[model samples]
Target chain A: MDTAGATRILAVVTPDSGLVGPGGAPVFMAHSQEEQERLALLLARIMGGVPHDLENGVYIVVKHS
Target chain B: MQNHVLTILLGVVAGTLARLVMLRSDYRHYPSYPHGFVTHISLGFIAALVGAVAVPALAKPDYVAATFLILAAQQFREIRNMERETLARIEQTKLVQRGSDYIEGIAGVFEARNYLVIITALATSGANHLWGWPVALGVAVISLVISHLLMQGECVGDIADVVPGKVHFDRSLLMVGDVVIMNVGLPAFREKVLEEGRGVVLKPRDDDARLTLDSIGQRQAILHDISVILGTKIDEKEMEFMPLAKKNADTGEIGIFLLPNEPDLECLVEIIKKVPVIESSKARPLSSYYGRRAAD
Candidate 1:
């Protein structure tokens, strides 16, 4: 099995656009695909796990079985 | 025959008398100045004048010949003196040049560690030996080669010197990180936002939060945010906030920009202090970095 290719993943971070949140507070929206990856990475780092079958432009939290 | 002899005799007598008068005058007093040439010329002219006046008893041709001989002697003396003076001046200049080179060498070592004076000295020496077209071209080539080698050697030497004491030295001051930030972001934002006659206000998520900028764009935004936070009314239509990468003009502290949020500004300083100074591996001629503007 090609373990290196199978396990290795790359994430590219980019700037997000500003948006109005539910509380009328100015919250930066993760508009760019790069920002989405960054958010996923941040979430995973914080959670201490990676998600299974991650979406294209959403937070991914991977888990080690 | 008697008249010819008399003319020759009188010319010599006149020339000798004039020389004696000059030798007694200021010529002997001011030895430093080229008084010898003045003495010979004045005496030669006086002899010629006196010989012309006394030529009534002597043959005109003999008198003329005598005058010419006196003039020739004067010229010969003057030329010899001039040659000696020229050699002395050259020696003096060489001495001064060597002294200058020594001072420059010491300064280069202390102030600008990436400086070399030997290359300049070698180039000047080479120029002295070489002359027209081929030599001129050769000297130029050699100078450029020497300069490059010197720069490379100095850079390598600096790195070697610094590497051993890297842990002890504060390396952040030497880093061109601010220059990198300026190059990457300032121009882009300056054109897109500032130049386009648009007013944009940036405020931190938390009122107490200090924005730590990694690029010039972020720095500019932070500056704008600071001005707004301070309630400083900047006419965005007329005035644009220029984020200059400089320290406080009043204080000697480096990398401290004029911006709002006192705590954040202090934090930026702390962060910058931690970054290591960047080193250029390749050597380049300083002339290449200089622009062609005559005023500059």
Candidate 2:
């Protein structure tokens, strides 16, 4: 059973500007680090993905396939 | 004709008995429904019948009837395919899936056991045809014992040292004793995992064991077995609590981190030790001269 789901970046929540550029995934801009974390968590829950931190005031919700 | 009847009866009984003894339904193993038991036992009986009749048919100079045993070979091959298909289909629904290597190993075991039954029946009936019932009975017992011994697959305990390891977070990354399993940004998930997760490290005994542990399928099997026994916290929707067994490439040590429903580290170690070494992943690097030469 080879079920490697297509990994897609569902949403990117970032407080810092210029760190993330818009491409395949939609980016959600946040005023603070706490907001960014909160948005990532909410998106992960709703979309059934995992929230991963990029360590530069940025968090991304990735739906692992 | 009377002698052949007696021989076939004894052989089929012995073969069916062997299958019954081996058909154990455990917590981590297959589902042993009544239907499953019936299917396997019937197959065993047929295999035994074919084996038992072969000797008598050859002795009676009925070559065509004897050639029917050759068709049994083709029938037994379908059993392997059947097991593989069933298991592979079941794998899709599992949260902590049994890896392909594990599936292949199990399917192969099923096929091999049928062959063992055939051999037991063949040997027993042959003994009866050549000597007497007393010798045939002894031969059946001996072959069954050999089959039982062969069924004992090698486990992690045989080739590694299993020990409890600390589950901690290196910033956002979840680390089980320096081997980073996965990264998490959700504070909710991080807190739950840190509070409830247990970690165990497997240090390979030697190079061969190291290579075996390196296989991704083997690692998945370890995780799947542990999750099955201990009960995983992860659900279909939530991937955050998914268990992972990550390897430390430098030292050939594996760090397994799982959020068990019951947080018993001791039992976790015991289960880790008992996890069967996946047959396909078992690489014997030290056995070859070139492999030995390469190993420093």
Candidate 3:
């Protein structure tokens, strides 16, 4: 893979809707903390990426190809 | 003329024998694919033939035939390209990849082995023409030993010490020693990593070793070798179990974390020690004037 093509954010899951802005990856807004973690992990498995916690209630599924 | 036949035949045998010995001695099961095995052997035979012919052709005063050896060198270069292209293409599908530096080292070794065969063939054949069959046989045996000695490359263990490191979570961050591997979002994922994941810190013996360990490609090679040998727990969709190596900025120690199917920490350490030092990644800081002064 090329230098820039290796890592990509496939999806983002956050409990607070205002925490993350709509950007490169699809953003999924979940209600509760439990739901946010579930959605993040589900999307991570689907996209073959790892769910990384930003520690601010935001989880990003980053694919390190 | 009779001696010429004996010289060429003996040279071919010696050269091909050198190639076979080299292949068998390698620790990594490379050329495991049937096609790759066949191709390497065929190329080795061709390399032997060219090398064997060189001495006889030159002795026979055949100027035209001598120039053919130059053509054979061009052919040898293509073998390096062929090996590199094949490995790079296959790298895409691997969960743990042999990095570009490792690939380049492998390709370069293949090309150098061909040259070794040429030298073995030339030496044996030249000996036969000068002396006789018995002397030629002795030359062949000695040349094979010399070739093996020449190819005895360094391993990671020679320059560093690998010891078990603590795999623990600092909040959401995975820590192997002081190196921060990565962040984990899912609590379940964090639990699995803490339970099953193994960590090892490779401590460099000197500044040169530290510089070598700092190479990203070299670190990737270490991870790939371990993942392949022990069998990774990573599945197609399970990227969380994937292995990683992170460098400690302060001490230049490399902290590696991997979830292996085997889970044998002892065996894992042994495998890490044996990881072939990537030629491109090796640095010689102590040998340089400025580097030596800076070390003081």
Highest DockQ against the true fold, candidate: 3
Residue by residue across B72-169, what tens digits does model 3's lDDT show? 76789998998899889999898888999999999999999999988898899989888988999999999999999988788999999999999999
Q: Write the per-residue lDDT of candidate 1 for residues A10-51, one digit (tens) a residue.
A: 222223332211432123346665555456446445544332
Q: Can you write out model 1's per-residue Cα lDDT over B103-209, one digit (the tens) per residue?
A: 22222322121111222222332332333234434544554455444333221112111111001102211112222112111122233322222121122121111
DockQ, ranked from best to worst: 3, 2, 1
lDDT of 1: 0.31
lDDT of 3 at B291: 96
lDDT of 2 by residue, B151-204 (tens): 998999899999999999998999999788899887777898889999999999
If scored against the real structure, what TM-score would every candidate get?
0.17, 0.95, 0.93
Between prediction 1 and prediction 3, the one with superior lDDT is 3
Instruction: Judging by lDDT against the true structure, name the best candidate.
Output: 3
Interface alpha-carbon RMSD, every candidate: 18.6, 1.0, 1.0
DockQ of each: 0.01, 0.73, 0.75
Stretches of model 1 off by over 4 angstroms after superposition = A1-65, B24-296
lDDT of 1 at B111: 19
lDDT of 2: 0.88
What's the lDDT for all of these models?
0.31, 0.88, 0.88
Worst 10 residues of 1 chain A by lDDT: A12-21
Q: lDDT at A58 for candidate 1?
A: 28
Candidates ranked by TM-score = 2, 3, 1
Per-candidate clash tally: 6, 2, 0
